[model samples]
Target: MQKVIIFTDGACKGNPGRGGIGYYLISDAGKTLKGSKSYLRTTSSRMELMAAIEALRLLKFPCKVELYTDSRYLADSVNKGWLNTWLASPFFLNRKNEDLWRRLANEMQKHQVSIHWVKGHSEQAQHRLVDRLASRACNSPKPLIDPGYFFKI
Candidate 1:
């Protein structure tokens, strides 16, 4: 099976403020496929989840994907299996970032995806690229949208 490597990162000006998500897609042979970054007026967690979701959507074909991100909340929640239990519950009963989590879980069901936790601002080339892209997205003049619909003040 063919493999795709994805590097993702999210940044927020504040814990619950303007944010941006970034990703870099590369083939197993080290060919750069694509790069994307998006801005949002939401929390770091939402951007983190959005980064993964957007990366998956960017893929044109089904392939084995290894997605790397700096957020342990995102990586562990999906990879360590908290998504299933969160989905089974209704009314959002104390769940955090429900909208982003649900969106991520839905997108995850559509592809062969794996999550890897990487150290932020490390020596990884792709990770640095994602950071630069995310910073650009955050500083760009693009209008931001609220991604965390379920998040209360």
Candidate 2:
């Protein structure tokens, strides 16, 4: 079986205004699936978490996955097991993006996944692709961009 690799990034226009999550998924045999979507009244961090959530959800069955992301908040939370500690503490009650973190935790339980923090805007071409997709989405409000918007992707 082929390994599953996912590259993700999130873009925000105004921090608390609109944001987008971009994900690039590729299988070991060269098959690929990738897209980005914009969300109203969302933060980049939320979208960062959402990108991973949506990317993992693409799998019909669990497999070994290497998820690459530019956001340290997303990577460190999962890879360092900070999410576990948060879930057990009252601090999680007031933590930002708790809902997404919980959802991420649930999605993670279903697969053999590892989160890797990749430096933003480096030599990785795929990262640039995801960044472009996400930024494009963040620049709009539908119809003018694409009909399906990203629901189809």
Candidate 3:
């Protein structure tokens, strides 16, 4: 199976405001893929989850994956099995970003994935790259609103 290293990041102007998601994927062969998306009404956690969701979605087939992210909410949710608990919950009520979480769960089932946490605003090049990608999305002239998500506040 192919191996991939993925780094994800998200940014938001306000807790419930303009947001963006970014991801950087590196294949075992050294190919690098990067992308970003912006949303007019979203939260940073949503963007972060979206980045991870998109990263896994890009995989053509199941493979070994090492995912890195700065968002503890995302990293911990998966790594600590909180997401599974939520999935096992009755109706998943009161869970934030349930839609994105469902998408993430679907994408994850397609591959072998592991989540890692990193410190944001660090000097790491890949980290900074994703950070820049997400930041740029927030600065786009006309970022489209994400139909998959909305801000509650």
Q: Which candidate tops lDDT?
A: 3
Quote the positional error of residue 102 for candidate 3 in Å: 0.7
Using TM-score as the yardstick, the better of models 2 and 3 is: 3
TM-scores vs. true structure, each candidate:
0.87, 0.88, 0.94
| Cα lDDT computed for each candidate against the true fold | 0.78, 0.82, 0.89
Q: How would the candidate models be sorted by TM-score, starting from the highest?
A: 3, 2, 1
TM-score computed on alpha carbons, candidate 1: 0.87
lDDT by residue (6-47, candidate 3, tens digit) is 999999888777888889999999999999988887778888
Query: Residue 69, candidate 2: how far off, in angstroms?
Result: 0.4
Sorted on lDDT, best first, the list reads 3, 2, 1
For model 1, the stretches where C-alpha displacement exceeds 4 angstroms are 29-31, 91-94, 149-153
Q: What value of lDDT does candidate 1 attain over all alpha carbons? A: 0.78
In the predicted model 1, the residue pairs found to clash are none
Candidate 2, superposed: residue stretches over 4 Å from native: 143-153
Question: Where is model 3 more than 4 Å wrong at Cα?
Answer: 148-153
